[model samples]
Target chain A: MDYYDIVMDSCSFPSGFEHALGFKRVFVSGRDFEPANTDKGEDAKGRLAIGHSSKNLLHAARRFAVAVVPMNLGLDRAFIETLRENSTILIIPLSVTYGASSDFALSTNMHLASKMLAYANKRKVRVGFATMARSFEHMESYMQLIELAKLIGASEDEARQGISLAGDLFGK
Target chain B: MKTKFRYVLVRSTTSLGTIDEHEFSKGLMHYIGATNYFKANPRVVKNIDGNSFIMKVSLSGYSALIVALALMKHVSGKECGFFTIYASGTLKALGKHIGTPGTETHSKSSNDVDNFANNNNI
Candidate 1:
């Protein structure tokens, strides 16, 4: 049985988890924020609070073989190294909020994808980029997806297929 | 070492409305002044084209983002405009100062800039 670890913001996990039970395991992750368990000193307010609290739902879903995905906002080398060590299938879901609407975000996503691809390729691991279902209506999201696919050296057909698969999997 | 910049001036060639280099310099300076990293005086020089010129401004390593953001803000929605940036060292130092990504030093040379520019496509 294959598990589809849906990487997303903490706020969006409940809905995704509800739909993802057919998979072997449903993993929920927070986007652009560290797991609360990992950071002790930081204040958890607003999004951070939500991200920290979302893990509570994971306990309820544990009977259904659901798991909380570990997330970290630290963009340092240590974070990348930790990712390499974990070696789990990494799913990065781009969100519509925050910096995603800007050109800077587009370029940053491409850069990040390339780096992840390089790391994963060397380790024989699989990494995927997912444009959140919420962002399907935005042209910039599609454009960023295409750009990310190209930067990660996915064939055009592969890129299209990946996006199509994601839409089918999560789109309302 | 003082850094020199080659720049092009863009304006409405047919319209009577005009802006002097001093005005441009002051506008850029005022924008930079809002940030904590930029402190040096900007030297503006006219290009061969009357409407275009280059302004040289010095800033600390941490101010690159400020410059990039300022440039992006300034050039947005303008026609006949061109801008380029060059950095002397790693972005990690700057990232550290800004309390962001501090450990990684990704390349920021012409190739990366070109890739970014080509991706953005004006």
Candidate 2:
């Protein structure tokens, strides 16, 4: 069985052991979002229930040997340029929401974001999806985001290969 | 020696109209848990000419700071995103690309800006 790496706010950590078991990796980072297990400081599994930085996430990605991690990819020319230059850290960028109906909004729409990711993949960058899910009920959004990445431009074989790579890196 | 920070120029894409610099700056500080940093240190949000703003942060924390800003989905029910425009070790270097307030001139096209940004970062 394979599990996904889920990034969420600290306060929304799984309600119980069963809920926690559903994910392979969980990263809870947000100042306004507090941790669920306030008393223990760490969860039952010894994972800290606190906020952290992108550097922490990067370290996690490195430790798991995952080629790509889902994160907020900035649209700024310099930031994007820096990203293209690094090439080592692959990221699946989050969609930029610009109000409900702006050209910026349209370009950052989920469909278009996936298309952009597809184009990036063609350039040999190991892109991954980091769709934010507020709660377990948001699984639908997560699935849709992944499906968007998998279905666009990627061949069936390529999709399967990517999955295999993810499993090899993250699976227990 | 005076402390130096990694200067970043950020463009706000989601605000419906012009951004309220004071409120947005406060929100940004809270979002990044820099409230104490703000209280202790001087405010770094300089050259708040329009939608774009320049900020100075600890050099080591630059990427993490950008990530924190990038993770924000909504603020007070308004959907928004922070796009990084330029980052440099010095405000002077960043000002070269973005220009100083009241003397601003954007010389490059959007596509060219992207290319320039991409080529120079690594």
Candidate 3:
């Protein structure tokens, strides 16, 4: 079953969106940093937790079958290992930065992303890459991203599935 | 031994209005030349619209052709970006979806186009 762990934004609960997307469950994170005025609740279909750092995200990972993480923060081995030990699927958002600022950024490193997937595969952890192509360069970045994923561990079919999954989740 | 190739449908967006087709083609070749992906020039598939076109590129085990198309930044001395509208393992699927062929005389060589479009990558 498809699952999501969307970081909460200020003007919305994100709970309703989970229903709209037809996901089995949507775990809302980054809410611990929000003001107390924000609503909180949990039921059989959805759950809202106080998530402020990588630790909280790992805590949530323990409960769900899959964990969705922002790549910037989830790249740490500790965070990845937490989910890996639980056998939780790791769905990482893959964003490729370009131009002057991106030359030194680790987030845009295709080789790094590929190695992470390979590591996950070696540990028997199910992993997925979520990508959104905002421009042509971003599209190229995604091509590199998926190709690298295949080079490391993911098969061609798995790479295609990752692309389709990203399109469905982000409407890219 | 035979080599298999992949065909990519790249949709370009430009800031300087309609770009010259020849320049666009040349820019792509130049951009690919800078990368270690492929050493040869890819075949230019006919342009479907002012901004979108198709190209046949050699498949070298990975999505190198698509990756090259994605990295293109400038064509004809103007800034531009190429977005992938659709990528498939078959030309028939792309032709059916885009409602256009690789050539203007599409009706005559529809079979040939289908044959050429049949690449093993998606």
TM-score of chain A of each: 0.40, 0.45, 0.49
**List-wise, what DockQ does each model earn?**
0.02, 0.01, 0.18
lDDT of 1 at B118: 52
Q: Compose the digit string of candidate 3's lDDT tens values, residues A8-91.
A: 332232234323222333322333222111112221111222222555555566555234443433355776686678666565
Residues B14-121, model 2: lDDT tens digits: 432454556665656654567544432323455444445566677655544554455444555565545455667755566565533322334533334345445655
Give the worst 10-residue stretch by lDDT in candidate 1 chain A: A65-74
Clash-forming residue pairs, model 2:
A81-B117, A81-B118
lDDT digits (tens) for residues B1-122 of candidate 1: 75432221122221112444444554455534545324444454223224222233454422332232222222223322122222223322212222111111234332433343356441
Clash totals for all candidate models: 3, 2, 0
Query: In model 2, which regions exceed 4 Å deviation?
Result: A1-172, B14-17, B34-44, B99-122
**Which model, 1 or 2, shows the larger TM-score?**
2
Interface RMSD of each: 17.1, 18.6, 10.5
What TM-score would candidate 2 get against the native? 0.35
DockQ winner among the candidates?
3
**Worst-scoring 10-residue span by lDDT in model 1 chain B:** B95-104
RMSD of 3: 8.8
What shift in Å separates residue A65 of candidate 3 from its native position after superposition? Answer: 8.1
